[model samples]
Target chain A: MKPSDKAPSEKALVPFVSVDHMMQLIHHIGVEEMMSGIAGYIEDDFHRWELFDKTPRVASHSEVGVIELMPTSDGEMYGFKYVNGHPKNTKEGLQTVTAFGLLANVETGYPMLLSEMTMLTALRTAATSAMVAKHLAPKGADTMAMIGNGAQSEFQTLAMKAICGLKSVRLYDIDLAATEKCAANLAAQDIKVVICKTPEEAIEGAQILTTCTADKQNATILSDNMVGSGVHINAIGGDCPGKTELAAGILQRSDIFVEYPPQTRIEGEIQQLPEDYPVTELWQVITGTAAGRTSERQITLFDSVGFAIEDFSALRYVRDQLEATGLYHALDLLADPDDPRDLFGMLQRAAPGNA
Target chain B: MKPSDKAPSEKALVPFVSVDHMMQLIHHIGVEEMMSGIAGYIEDDFHRWELFDKTPRVASHSEVGVIELMPTSDGEMYGFKYVNGHPKNTKEGLQTVTAFGLLANVETGYPMLLSEMTMLTALRTAATSAMVAKHLAPKGADTMAMIGNGAQSEFQTLAMKAICGLKSVRLYDIDLAATEKCAANLAAQDIKVVICKTPEEAIEGAQILTTCTADKQNATILSDNMVGSGVHINAIGGDCPGKTELAAGILQRSDIFVEYPPQTRIEGEIQQLPEDYPVTELWQVITGTAAGRTSERQITLFDSVGFAIEDFSALRYVRDQLEATGLYHALDLLADPDDPRDLFGMLQRAAPGNA
Candidate 1:
């Protein structure tokens, strides 16, 4: 290939960060510090939330699962993520969720970054929960109850410790092997890891309760009586229709806060409540327009269905890291002809012996 | 990176076709033959159009341009194209359009193929035009008048020759250099090329007419009086909201056929007509449910705004070609952990020394 405009040069190469590079970048920055940095970006974006073009994700549903496209543009840049959720995938030795994302420049509509977002999504989801809890959780809240010790449990536990000063996490799962796996994964962390036998015991004396079960159905991981006042509940697994983790009784007692009420109403824990139920937007709380944890007895619940802006924030954070760490390879994704109208000439020239 | 299930393995790597590889593949398969093959696939898909899940594209419009995601599924396979259009990019030595696409399995929600679609889009669009012309053009239409000699002109000319037995092409463009470039690119082909100085001379004695100008505004390259009866008009440039190439009178006088009614109504030549204006879906014509060209004196117009199914067909065809050609490499796109529940464990094991 020539160094002309038709070639895959700097103008045509899109920087791609693979799973290996993503893991190395995570280890380089340290998982906790990266999550904390992503939390900062999310908070900054939240303060300017009105400037973003917000829409509910475009979803394609099938009998087995759903594929979704989450897109947002902040006037200057555009970002989108492609993710799928097939609960039965875990049974097939596959991840229940796998994703990748792209970020593009608004002015030229040229992609700037393409990244494997499955790991990045996990980091962003946990960072978001912890970031919201930092605003809504009670003062000096240092202990979190992490129920549903699956893929997301360790990240959630660590984010709480890194972002919200969570000191200890009590883990519980119906599958004891999953709990054992999570406990083993977290054995080297600084925080205390407590293995609980039941969901009630997992929430005992913890000011923050995080539920991340992976069942694709409405299963009550937390009952109304198990949650105490002044506790912040970070619900993570109730991300799609017919899959909820908390009972309606628990939702009724907690003062709910959500990211994008329209989406959370359909896919978040708030889906169980009435359509017009009053819920404070977490952006408003972050922007100081709405109150967060007004008193010790105030029960604040961050119903996290995860939003496009949070993914956008995480993508933005990773893109910023690429230049410094050089953990990326360029993919020749775009066809760039020297003369814009001479694309056929370029193709003809590329023939064997023609060039 | 371990192969014990949480690393980039055969399950995680999506086959990628870069621009360089795409050019090599095109040369390997020959452009005209590839277009003819894609045409066959398009016809096959059109015959079963009712089985597809079709929707209008999701477009994010900016001041300078627009980026769109076009997705479709056939219950077995899912496909989507990411394309951007920036008309001003040409002046800055950039492509007006660039695209990439992906094909995924609907059952497992894992990507199977990731391809650079800028060149593929060109092939598919031309194939769709020529395939429709085969069904709608007047009998013995061996000559075509190609107006607006931009990036798509040469492909249209070649496709007509390859698919419809077109023997001659009369080319006219606002920029004379674009026409010269197209003619030079087609010199090796077994067809007669005639360069016309004006649109009137270009359409003289031509039975098929194709308009593919790239202006973003509504400028009529072909007026009503210039187009005579008994000719098929392939309109390709009127694909976005404010972009059109034909006069309203020309649309009124011809029997219009479109890919999808809802999308064509907003983005095709039919946008000039009344909201209740009657038009036929081209799939119906392809499947023998509707008439194409009933009489030699009747004028037919294929209002091809391009559809997702045509791209799906192209992607499917490419995926089928990959195994035999081996013109592809894998991108470590998906995060596949051996134990689906231990994503954190996968990450922890990916550290430099830990692995």
Candidate 2:
């Protein structure tokens, strides 16, 4: 065959892990084990967080929803995730959030991986919470109170189980059907599951409280009275301005740890608190610069606002898995010409058959 | 098949236009005709420029190159382009720039289209220049002096011919091979092609002067003495900061026009000019609020640094063509659970056989 007719070179093909592949990979590694693996990567990245390029995500808000681009680089590698959140989408049988991401080599500015990030985002968010909880969760914490059990509910539960060695989870949601779905999905797992009718009942004897709901408004998923000292709280649902989960009373009572203060203050649970409220950076805790769980009776809240570096870590992990599993498709997403300057020549030579 | 075993739902699949498909689409419509079609879309969008949500692109700069995310939105649809530039990539047999983009519905915040944009960007950049020249070029202008015949050289020439009714092109490049490649690419076209040894030779009797060199520094491709009156200049190569093709003397002599003043002041040829240097916004001219070419002897310059709205227009045009031409593949890039909240249940159902 002539050079013109040859298949595209590897550089022109970005390794794309589709939804199906991501699912298969998760199953291949076991969901809990995969979450543990992802948490490990997040921990590695968080330890070296100073090396990352961080910026507040670029968001475009419309009447019903918001779309955002979260980008970051570590001198050698770069990544970005395109995600959208529309709380009303579920009513139309669509996901409330869907996402995709790209990872590229910073040296050549060429993409190395293109992967579906809806599933991956769910994984990474859960992993980040669990990884943070490892440092802050009370010693031998075995029970978790999972409120607002929606799409993210179960992942958060299993990630806690995998990374923190939790043996039981008590789930609660305002919607009974959502609670039932979470309970049924976990029935096959080794961990014990409890379905609680009220948020108060879910927190009974639980040391870890994970609240993940889907609402665009600031709804009180957990009030101050329900949270107690010596327990760790993972607040992930409050991830945008004007949308928060924990009551201001709970925030006042707890020592909050955050991903990036600039972002968390705007999007996380602390959006309810004063802008100048002091919160410790999670990376500092991981890097041994700040204290984590200094006292058993001290309430600790991981005010989680998903950051770009966690997604970058997830992309890096997925890219490393591609070669071993062969669970990816080579997407012809870039134009490659033999003579890089002659793009027009390449187009001319590849004129359509009908033309 | 079980519901879980069935193919992904429509909402889970995003339409992806690969490079091969883009080339096929371009060939089917003819390059000149395709660019004119794009120019038509651009004109329509430019007429309503005030409605767009615009922001300066977010760029990640490394030692060797830069990657950027350019995003914009109309009230109904939003779009963004991810592009990277690495000038040294040519030595590694890669294009200096490559890109891909997405368009989404503002109402749902779900992506509607994903397309390879290296080819599309080239087309849009050329079409934008020709579209601006059509409004600002001297009336009945026929010959264009094409300096720095690189990747974008052929498209610029043909777009001028197709949109502005140019009859001939005079090509010149510092590198002889580039000029030869451009000349050979145009040999199949109907327009007259002339190869010149130097920038001065290329401008002989040409009414339009187009400069598009790929360099990261300020270089005087066109001196003040080389440019005469009654001519239009399309200065596109001077895009990033510290990159300029025309000397300040030439800019001072011409009536500079730009896409967006805020960005153009930083990235366009006008970057060399004072911060408050007066320049006409090109969209205003299209909107009839600002004057374009009025006097024959008046020197006109289009300091073209690409804007996000142009990429949005290109994405819209490509998306509109997808249905009619059936030129895209539906990529399973989103996870859609039967119950939106049952993502974990979906994962359980799709557990790997090896497990």
Among the numbered candidates, top DockQ falls to 2
Span of ten consecutive residues with least summed lDDT in model 2 chain B: B1-10
Error of 1 at B272 (Å): 1.6
CAPRI level of candidate 2: high
In the order shown, the candidates' DockQ scores are 0.84, 0.87
Candidate 2, residues B1-355, lDDT tens digits: the string is: 2554446888889999999899989977889998999999999999989999989889999878899999999989999999998889988899999999999988888899999999999999999999999999999999999998889999999999999999999999989999999999999799999999988999999999999988888999999999999999999899888889999999999999999888888888998989999999998999999999989999999999899999999998888898889999999998998887877777777775523
User: Taking the tens digit of each residue's C-alpha lDDT, what string does model 1 give over A1-355?
Assistant: 3536345668889999999999999999999999999999999999999999998998889999998889999988999999999989999998889999999988888899999999999999999999999998999999888999888999998888899888999999999999999999999998899999988888888999899988889989898888778898999999998889998988988899999988999998888888999999988998889988889998898889989999999999999999899999999998888787888877877777754
**Which residue segments of model 1 deviate by more than 4 Å?**
A1-7, B1-7
Question: Candidate 2, residues A42-81: lDDT per residue as tens digits?
Answer: 8999888998999999999998999999999989999999
Per-candidate local distance difference test:
0.91, 0.91
Q: Cα deviation in Å at residue A86, candidate 1? A: 0.5
